[model samples]
Target chain A: MGRQYEIPIGAQHISLLEPLHFKFTTENEKIVATEANVYYVHRGIEQACCSKFKFRQVSFVVGRVCGLCSISHTTAYSQVAEKLLKIEIPLRAKYLRMLVIELDRIHSHLLCLSHVAENSGFEALFMKTMQYREFSMELLEAVCGNRIQYDFSIVGGVARDLKPQVAQSILERLKKFIPQLDELMDIYKNNWTLSLKNKGAGAITKEDAMRLNVVGPFARAAGLAIDVRNETEDLLPWKQVGFEMITETSGDVYARNMVRLRELYVSIRIIENIINGLPESALITETKAFPDGEATVRLEAPRGELFYYAKGNKTQILERLKIKAPTFSNVAAMAEAFTGNEYGSAPAIIASYDPCLSCTAR
Target chain B: MNKVMTSIENLKKDIGDFYKPELHHFMVMNAVEVGDQIEVQWFFSDYAHPCDTTCFYTLVRPETEIPSIKDIVASAWVAEAELVDLMNIKVENTQKGFVLEPDFESGPLRKKK
Candidate 1:
């Protein structure tokens, strides 16, 4: 009297952004089970890296771990290397790192929201969000010399300091995004169609969410109250600045959207704080020599927590670099969250978690 | 405690025989180089599996030989292989049995190379 069903989302499809196979076992339109077949896009990134590159050079290399999270990758990597070397970067350098990383978070979250809008057939919102994103992208290019791959963080410090004029100009640009983000959030909240589509979709209980160790905005939306920045005292310059961790008890698509929108403002405030109270000191180290040791470093990326372990043998080449990116752990939670969601709402629900397959596959 | 060591030692003792052999205690681990020797410290807890730290006692093996802990830990096998691949350190008797083959011409991080 028992029967089972299996349907495969094959890897060969043009719409599939990365090479991954999902075997969805379903009963009618309800997903009963999901089996993920990854490793298709596994490029042996961990296998390929070794002592051949200097700590500074490795920043650019690991920055490719995910375009959406390049800042997080480089920041974590640099922090680990700096810890190993026992070097305290100038206070200005730390603030600069905070500034750039938070900006990256803003761009990443907006991009995710825009993609969510696009998936939900809200074309106008998508176009408008993209137009707003251009300003942030341009700001990144103006400051760090590249749009996506910002080769900013060096082992001891940043490659360059934010010039006063550049900082002022960037502040003006950030001000322009505030009203726009507010308008977008208002639309998401008030739009009947969007609300009906997103509300109560892919909801998870707070207990279940905590038991699964779900992180980033998803867990917060469910009231887990975990943020790498807030959890670790050593992690932030929080006392000098102010921002609240946004939470929503619903834990649905709507909750996730609100948390992310609030995070955009939080990121902007953090950047503003860094610029205003920036310590006057050197940004880059005078010596390029690295120390012989190993260190584990963790940082709050736009998505969630990222960790890196590095070893150096007192040479230009690093002894080893092993990283654990957020997408790796978040994907499992995504699969779990996907259950009971309508098939038609799958793309938007998936986008709600902001899947960066490159981060996962890399 | 002695009980922890006895349990770990029961698995393997040779420094080069187990495959990515790790013991999780629910905390974190970092490898620190002190003078001429390497010291790997485990920051562990009694809870939180998969994501938390485990107390790992390992030996460098030329081939895979680490015993199965699937009953205890869910994703230890793949995680071990990842560590071996990234660090070029070996663990013996793993699920894969053999680590990635050393077909690449150069060892980028090893000083002897």
Candidate 2:
């Protein structure tokens, strides 16, 4: 402990989208330990869900948990509610849900990659990634009528159906976007400056990740083959839509970026498959049942596994609603990643985790 | 989903026996208040087959201090601290004020008046 001191990084920082406070204890410019405070954005959504909102209305309310992964929140909440209601959605509705989820995954990954680039001091790459990310946003707007916080998912099924022309347009846009993604992947992989900055800055080994209960791209990047989409087949037919889990063994910032980029391709492929094999059915089912039991739902959000627990007592209002966001689970791993790294690279390491404080604090 | 009801004293032993890091990934630890008791659920899953979930729940008095599983599953500290802040459930060897600011009171997830 020779001349040890503490440096604080944002409750509001340029690299962070939401408020997250980190106090890094450093000695000779290397981090020895870290303390994180992520409660700045807590809005009591869990209590509000049980006390304020009805079962049918909770899906839309939970969608406000995080703007980027709002689809994941809505999907997780709807699945839990649907389980309690015992509603089996139609094939067409399932396909539409999968389509929008894949779209959301693509945009969310691109946003994260761009943020990582910006934090790593590659401003040009950040701008380029943002430019390519616009295509996914435009496609989402065309389908869901809004860029962010799209309330396309309802309890029994989806709120809107995708038109034939909209599907065709999505296919065309994805076709045009693949080449751009390939070029971006090339740059991400081969850029010497980026590789130097991110290659091993926040590396966490497989054992540490497992012990820390890491999820999603971070876990997958560390060689963990855990994906909720691969596990939960009853919710959606991800296999039928050509969903494949992408993994990297490095468990570093570069590895995380590679995993996200590759998953973007996987999401695009799933969207294309859904468009090609889309079935025709009712957008939403007519169900007059009320929830009277408890159900737990877990889904793979862009960052990681988003979990929701809902309990009802044969009434319109729920008894309790519990949400454990991926970032909430990854908090320990995030703190661990800060250790054994230089203080200067903290922003890039934090950005590589792609934390959603609003989701975590909710 | 498999549900196992255990007592507060046997929670650590039961969870220690059930949680195999290679086979099960710790999902989350959740606590809900029921009348005079607080129902705590520890969720774990087989990542290879995620549909298979093992849930271990224990009901305790609101003031009872639950043993922390941070020694077994290191990441559980976050969840343990969260329960302390949100549900007002006391847990041993865990920090408070994770989701609530230091100046604010705890138990935001509890029933309101």
- Stretches of candidate 2 exceeding 4 Å from the true structure: none
Interface RMSD of 2: 1.2
State the lDDT at A286 in candidate 1.
Answer: 59
Q: Model 2, DockQ value? A: 0.81
> C-alpha displacement of A45 in model 1, angstroms?
2.8
For A248-271, candidate 2 gives per-residue lDDT tens digits of 998999999999999998998899
The CA lDDT at A183 in model 2 is: 99
* Model 2 TM-score, 2 decimals: 0.98
Docking class of 1: incorrect
Off by over 4 Å in 1: A1-4, A10-16, A233-236, B1-57, B60-113
Individual DockQ of the candidates? 0.12, 0.81
Worst 10 contiguous positions by lDDT, candidate 1 chain A: A230-239
TM-score of each: 0.81, 0.98
